[model samples]
Every structure is written in C-alpha cells, then in structure tokens.
Target: MAAIVARENLTYKRWDFPNCAGRIVNMDEDLRAVGERIRSLMPGELSQRSLAERAGMKPDALSRALNGQRGFSSQELAHIADVIGADLHWLVTGAVDPRRVRIAARHAWDSDRGVRVNPGRAHDEELLGHVVHAYNAAFPDGPPPSAPLSDDPADMGATLGGSFVRKFGSVVESRLGVDVIRLPMLSTDYSLTIGSRAIILLATTPNWFRSNWSLAHELAHLALGHHGGDQAPGEAEELPADEFAAHLLLPEELVRQHDWQAMGEQGLARFLWETGVSTIAAKNRLAKLNIRYSTEVAVALKQSTPVAVRADAGDERGTFERRRAIILRQQESSTRAMPPILAEALQRRVEDGAVSPEDLAWVLDVSVDEIDFPEPDDSAAMAQAYRQAFENRPSHADLEAWLAANGKPAR
Candidate 1:
C-alpha cells in the first residue's frame, strides 16, 4: 500500500497498491523499501545519489533514506514519484497501482480538455497528437525534425526557447499562465519539444510578421502532436500530421475569405496590412491555400530593410549621437584625436537625454580615451550642435583609432 506523508513530519496514510490489504508503515526499513522500488523503475545505471539529484533531493539525504537511516517525507516521496512516474500511494503506503493513476490523468483531459476556455473544441493534447500522427504519416521512414518551428520569423528564435520549458513542464505553466521560475535559454535558433513542452524560436533579424508566423507554425506542431518517435509513420515522407497542423491553423478558408486570388503583390500587401498578417506570411498562407503568385513579380514592396526596425531614431535618439556629444563636452579644449563619428552619434543621444553618454559610447563601440576630456560650459548645447554638424557623416572610419585605443568594437 502507498501512503501520503505530510511534508513536515513524514506522516503516512495507507492507500491501495493494486490488489493488497492496506497497511500503515513507519519504520525506517519501510522507507528504504519504498526507495528500492523507486530505484527499480528509474533509468538503469543510476545510483541512489544520481536519482536523488535528478529528483532535486540532497544526495546525502537520499542516501540516508535509501539506507534506512532517515524517514521519507511527503515532498521527497512526491518528487521521486514525479521523476519515475510512480503513484504517490505506491511510493508512500504501497497502495494503488501507478498505472491506474497515469490512465486517470490521461483520461482526465477529456473532461477538462486541457482547454479551460473552450471545452467543446480540441485540447492541446489532442491537437498535439494530431500533429504527431500527421508527421509520422508524412515521413514514414525519415527521421523527425529536431524541434518545432513557428512560421513567423520574428518569434521563431524566442519561441523555441520558451517552448522547451512548455513542452517539458505542465501545459498550464507554459501557456495562459506565466512561469514564475524562468528557464534558461538552451539554443537561440531551434525549438525544444522534449516531454510535454513545445517551443519555437525565431530570429530577431526577421520582422514581427515572420516571427509571428514561426510561432504559429510551431504551435501547430505541438497542437498536432508531431513529436518524433517510432510509433509514428516512417521518416521518408512528409508527415501527414504536420500537414494537418499547417492547414488547420492556417486554414484555407481564411485565404478564400480574404479573396486573395485577385490581389497582386501590392494589393496583397495591402490586404495583409489590413488583416494584420505579415506580407511574407500572407503569401505563404495564400500558397498553402492553393493560390499562386508569380515569384518574378513579387518585387521589393517595403521601403526599408527589417534591420532598420531595430535601429534607433535617425539623428535625435540614436546611441551614436549621445556618445559624440559627451566626448565633445568632456574635452575642455581640442585634442590630437577628435571624437569618433561613433562618439558623435552617442553624444547626440546623450544631449537628447535618451541615455548617458558613457552608456551610448559603450554601445556604439567606443571606449573612454585616456587623455583628459573636455568640460564644455554648455554641455547640452555643444552636444546638440555637434549632432547637427556630424549627423550626416557617411561613415565612421575616423573613429577606428579611438575605438581601438579605448578597447571597444569598431562601430
């Protein structure tokens, strides 16, 4: 029988452990017996200490508990149960079948559906299962993808990192609720889908639309349950599960509803803007809907590169402006080396009060010069004027020596 112990005193309550008469046990020997059972189901080649580490228990305490020198507390026993997927009752009182608990937990989703918002609709588990099955069908003989992907480029990188925690931890913890404990970043590019977690990481270089698409796409993978495994189809083919996810989330109906067939690239762009979808995603979504566009004709529609979005304000708010102003003001008089153009940019930002000149210099790849800096009486005015004077400089090559001398990256 298994028993539930309180965290403080390690009290035990008899619970059924399959077909057996319930019995209460308090002896240290009983605790060792439970520890031995945990050791057996856990991964082979793992010692009591290693198992303890895996379950976040102290090594010495685990050793003592296994040696019948210490009692097993409820928290410790619960952690062990979680690690080995054992039933609490079985771990504590030697009552109740662990299998029954697993079955019950899996089935419980039907009532709650794992989607508290919409009960009638599909739950995350079912959606994930669908993707898994589809992927299996598509690639019956081929190896599965290493991680999930969000069609959105903007979010793909971060999403993958976030998804790693979500897939392994509880769904409740991952979605709709914030995890108070933040997981460290595993990889910047790829998503991790270990266990129940499903993550999608997007590159920051991509625009928000691309990021959003990647996130959505990766979510589809999890929703469809596209975990790579032997039970699914062979690897050579396009997994049916993945297809189901793509089509389901990026439904064909959305494209038809938007009348995408008649829109040209610009028109499509307009439509996407109206619909709040990225131009790239809109095109892909249309393609998935069996709509076609001429690649040759899809010329550059946006005025600026995606990188510009991350850049600061042109003359007013850039880091470059701030650094320059600070250097010029600090110098009481001109020195052999003029402030680098990078410094000028930093100075401009400092004058604008966006950031301290020092911070701006550091970011703009400038370092403090060893020589005495100027002390302009009207520091603010000098910064603003310098910003205007050098704001239009084509390049920052002149600042190379200053940057090198200061041990900063050349901007």
Candidate 2:
C-alpha cells in the first residue's frame, strides 16, 4: 500500500488498534462505523472537502464516496479514519469498540516517561474523546448539576473553580489531591498530576471566567480517567483536552439557548453572563459548535478581549512551563528567552499537557530570558505593535493570520 505522506516532516505517528486488547470480529463494516464516530466528535458544518484536505486527499473524490455515489477504497477509508483520529479496525469491523480503540489511539502520543511526557504533545479528535470519556467515567452524568449562574460571568468562573476545589477535592483527593495554586508562572492554566501521586495542579489567571473554565477542563481530564498511569502526554497533545474542558464546562444546550449565533461582540459578551464562560472561551466554543450562521457569525466571534492587564493573586504567571524550558534549552542552544505573551501561551499549553514551551519558543522565534517569576499583576500591557496602531488597533484576524503565517498562536 502507498501510505499517505505528510509534507512538513511531521513528527506524528498513528497507533494501530490492539486486536488482543478487545475482541475483533470484522473490520470492513467497522470502518464506516468509525467514520461516523469521528464525525460525531467533530464540530458540525465542517465540509467533507476540508476533512479530506486534512487527510491529504482530493475532496471531490471523497465526497462522491461519502455521498454513496461511489465506493471508497480500503486505503482511502483507512486514511480518512486516521486523519480524524479514528480507529481503522473499529471503523471497519465495529469489533474493536470505542474504549479499546480510544486507548490504542491514546498510546500514539507516548514518549519515554515522567516530565518527558509533559511537553511535545498535540491535541486532536482522538484525545478529545478520551478526555470526554474519562470525565464521564470520573463524574458520571456530567458535572454535579449546579444551579444556573447568579453572578457575573467573570466572577462565576473564579467562584466555580474555587468551589469545585473545596467541594470535590475530598472525593478526588483520594485519587488525586487538589493543588490550589497561584503559580508565579505567567500562564493562567493548571495541570493534571502524573505518575503515582496523581496530584491535580489548579491555577488561575486574571480572566476569572476563562480560568474557571480551564480548571474544570483539567478536572475533567482526571475524572475522565485519561491523565494517569504511564500514559505519556503525547496521546493527549493533539487536541489538548482543554478545548473539550471549555465545552463541557459550558454545555452546548446553554450556549444554543442564548442564540449566541446571532449575538455580536457586545451581545456575546453580555451573553456570557448567563452561560458563565469568559468571552475568550465562549468565542472559541462558538467556533467549534458549527452552527447555521457560523461563517458570518465567526466574524463577530473573532473579536478579541483586551489582554487582561492585571497582576494579582490569580494572575501574573508569565507564560512558560518547567518542562518546556528544559526541552527548549536542550533543543536550541542559542536561544535563551521568550516574549511575555508567547511565553505565557506556551505555558498554558504545557500545563494543559499540550505543547512544550521550548518547542513553542523555538517555533515562535523567541528566546527565554532569565527565569524570573513575577507576582500576578492586574494590569495589562500594550505591546509596541498595538501602541503603533493608535486608535485603529489591529484586528484579531490580522493577528491570527500573522500567527498562521509565522506558525504560532496569535501573540
């Protein structure tokens, strides 16, 4: 078989579903089943063409088969399954089962052990299911059915995170003790424990609502049974369960009820009051929902929040993780520091066990300066680029496009 090849010297590999881990009856029929499974985990409104593009195939050809106008070859079917992070065997036979396939997919990201697993991870569809399943098992039927929000969205995020730690810590403490922290680090995210202790490190940044959402997502990773054992961080890297954390934290039902699809920046910001999610998280989630007005609606969703200009108890953690630093230093001898913003973003990714700081810094063309941990401040800083823009500030689209061109998240 001529295997599909990636152009960018991709450092990614796929793990075959374990035939022995579970009963394997048939595979061809299972392939269709797996395709449906992958589609379920994806956002609605995505084009078959785009999905095919991700799989490195011609869309017209894929669409024809998907629409049942033609038959898909076995290799084409397997490639589609792989691109969407589906188990080929499960998709073909329905014999491998979701749990076994999910576990097999999770193992693809493993690299050595210990802190080595912390960085160099990618998050995609496969990890998303693992995270969700793990959370469902850990919490059973969703979160502890809390009453709707009675406070501001920002306040709700903080209060909920604090409340969860206080209330659920006892239950989780047996398996994973809660570390209520205000890390000197720049990022506003927390982490799940590794190896034996299974300690869950919960941190908060200035945006209370986003911070709270992150905490919930981290908790979900633990409850979902995805973060423990010898499982390396790589398995969860593709779609850093954090994305799902935000979604599960803010249920789709509540979001749809608000008709957030029609809301503009101000309206969406106002809508956050009822949903209890921050503007940033809400926007990202909105993008993933694949609603009717998504294309046009994405215009409004692309709006940016002023970087939380503060340094306080739940803020001031500069971006960059301990593990990322080790990796970046080892990878780039000439580099020594990172810009404040990029550093923080990479840090959050690391805490979420997504990407390592060193790789992020290298990718972003920044070097890590002295390891200075500052207290969380409440003031947001305007970078030179912003200052130069004067009244007509650069749009989020401009930044995102730039980041895409530069191969990094918008600064």
Candidate 3:
C-alpha cells in the first residue's frame, strides 16, 4: 500500500483494493474482545503506537483500554471506535445494537466519493461493462491501434482546456458525440458528467498536469459508463473510474519502453513531465505493475511543485485568462488591448477615485484630452469608455505572447 501510495493512484481512491476488505469492514458478530476487534479492524502492518495516536489515546492508556484494565470514557471510546472503524456499542458489549454506527463508514460519500452537493448511486455497470465489450466485439484483438498514440501530453486539448482534455477528449466528443464544456463557475470545483457529455475541468488544480489528469479522470467516469445525468456520481462507481484513468493515462507499453530503473532523476523528471500523470498516479501505477525504480526523484518531484503539467495553464482560469489575452493580441495599430478582467477592475478603481485622470492618460499614452471619462451616472458610456481605454492600452509584445503561447504564430 505504501509503495502504491508513493506511486500516487489516479482516482481519489485506489480502485485496485476491494473497498470492503481494504476500508469498510463489517463484523458478523459483536466482538466480546475489544482489543482483538481494534487489531482486526486495523491493517496488520500498522503499528500499535500509530493506532494509539490515531485513537487519541496515550500508548499506555491504549494498552490499558485494549487489555480491559481500564474502562474508556465516551470521548475516548468514540475516538477509539473511529480509528478502528468499529461499532462503539458492539465493541463494548457482545451484542448488536440497531443504533450503533461505525464512524468510518457512516458517511454516504466517504473515501472515493469525496464531496458532492447531490450524488445518486448512478453508476451504470451494464453500460460501463459494455464499453470494452463493444470494443472486443468490434475487433477481437487482431487489429491494434494503427499506430501507437504518439502525441505529446501538452497538446492533448488542442485548444481551450489544455491538459484537462487530452486524446480521450476527442473520443468523447467526436466519436461519442458528447458535449465538453468549460465554465468559470467550476473554477474551484472538479468537472462532472452530465448525461453523456464530459465536463473538462479547469479549476480543481493550479497546475496543468493535475488538471489534465482530472480531465482524463472525468473521462474515465464517462468511459466506465457512469451516466450521471443531472445527479452527482455514486461512490460505487469511483473505483473503476480511477482504475480506468490510471491505465488510460499511463499505458503499460509507455511505462515499459522507458525503463524506470534505467531512467534516473533527470530521465524520470522528463518522463514525468511528458506523461503529465500525478506523482502519486505514476508511483502507484509502477507499484501496481510490480515494477521497481528509484524513489529519490519521485520524492523530490512530490515536494517541489504540485504543478507538473506541460499543458498551457494549470487550471481553467489560466485558459480563460490566456484566451482573453489572445483576443487582445491582435493590436489594430491605434487600438491597444486592455484585458477584460483588468478593464473591469480598473473601472472600479476609477469610480473609487483611486485612479485619477492622470493615471488613465498615462496608461493610454495620450494627454487628458484623449482620455474619455463618461459622466458619473452614465453606466453605458462609462462601460464603453472603460472598454475603449483597455482596447487602446495593450502593447504589441503582450498581444504576441498570447498568440505564441496558444500555438498561433503571429502573422
């Protein structure tokens, strides 16, 4: 598990492990032996000292509680039950209580589901199961991809969302005919599936690689046949989606081609950057395949920057900002560009009297005569002048930067 963790699995939860066995534990009978129950619930490898700290009990106190030498307070019992995911009442008395609840598994959307405003158990196993089935049925293994997928990860989105939508995005839209939309409303949130379309996320991560991984992650949900319509996705479907993402983003062939043991820090860094998978995803993928490699580079990558993507922007805001910048890149000789966001903010500043006419004149490179300020209450003229002020303010180099970054060579 530590090896897999070092590798970083794609989905919020590692789908390879059975949730029931790895996390949610159910007891057939109430445990008469409280100490045994705690030990049984915890992974065999975890230390007692670690469990003690988790349970908010001192080492000796935990031993006393486990040994039945001392009775635990309600608070202590709650913490203990939480750590081991035991039914507090059942752990105390060897009887089932209908009211008893295990703290760990109580939440409707715990480990994999994470957080959601409204989630329904809406994973379509049959629909998801049919995907590979459909592929197998169409081509029973003879005809592989005409050519190995050979696009750099950075160019995945082609435009707009960048890493958030890579090659799979084309399949989702062109082949599947699903709608892929990017909205600023989801700036701080991850993307979702609405019926068949994929929501290419931009706000979840500040870096491009993570956002792109999310792009692949959400695509996995759709690929796995999660028809989330208007409701949020259920926890039941999270595992497969995660597993699909890990395999899809970092294919085995790619991993094998570049030997990890051979690829030291620099090579690994290049591979990590090119692939754009999270450090955790890469580590866990390697561990899952039982492939061993140097961890020094992986650890350093983890600590340095969360931004691992070569994609244009780390998140959606970057995309929006870039697009806005791109628009103003085409300077119409006399018409310089002012960024929309900056224009709005500047307008606010002007109204606040923080920006005088001198400032506006200075920004425009013209005298006060050329700078136009509409009457205080004239909202329409004020807005028009504000926009004009920005249109006449952006430099030639600023325009070129936006164009060049977006792969559009300046004419």
Query: RMSD for each model, in Å, please?
Result: 24.7, 26.1, 27.7
Question: In order, what lDDT does every prediction score?
Answer: 0.42, 0.42, 0.47
TM-score: the better of candidates 1 and 2: 2
lDDT of 3 by residue, 196-258 (tens): 123333232234455455556655555444532223455565666566667666767778887
Task: Residues 1-411, candidate 1: write the lDDT tens digits.
Answer: 366656465544455645555644444457667767777677676676777887677899777776655677767788787777666766665654311201000111224443212222243344333323322222233222233334442243234343332131223233322111111121121222423223333323223343333334344444444433223222222234334434533445445765443444445544443333344545455656677655422442233323222232246565466445334322311111211322444455556555444544443335645312445569899889899888876556768877888999886
Q: 1 or 3, which is superior by TM-score?
A: 3
After superposing candidate 3 on the true structure, give the runs of residues whose Cα lies further than 4 Å from its correct spot. 1-176, 185-205, 228-232, 305-411
Give the TM-score of each candidate: 0.29, 0.31, 0.34
| Cα error, candidate 1, residue 200 (Å) | 4.9
lDDT-wise, the better of 2 and 3 is: 3
Instruction: After superposing candidate 2 on the true structure, give the runs of residues whose Cα lies further than 4 Å from its correct spot.
Output: 1-177, 186-190, 194-198, 202-204, 235-240, 261-264, 273-280, 293-300, 306-411
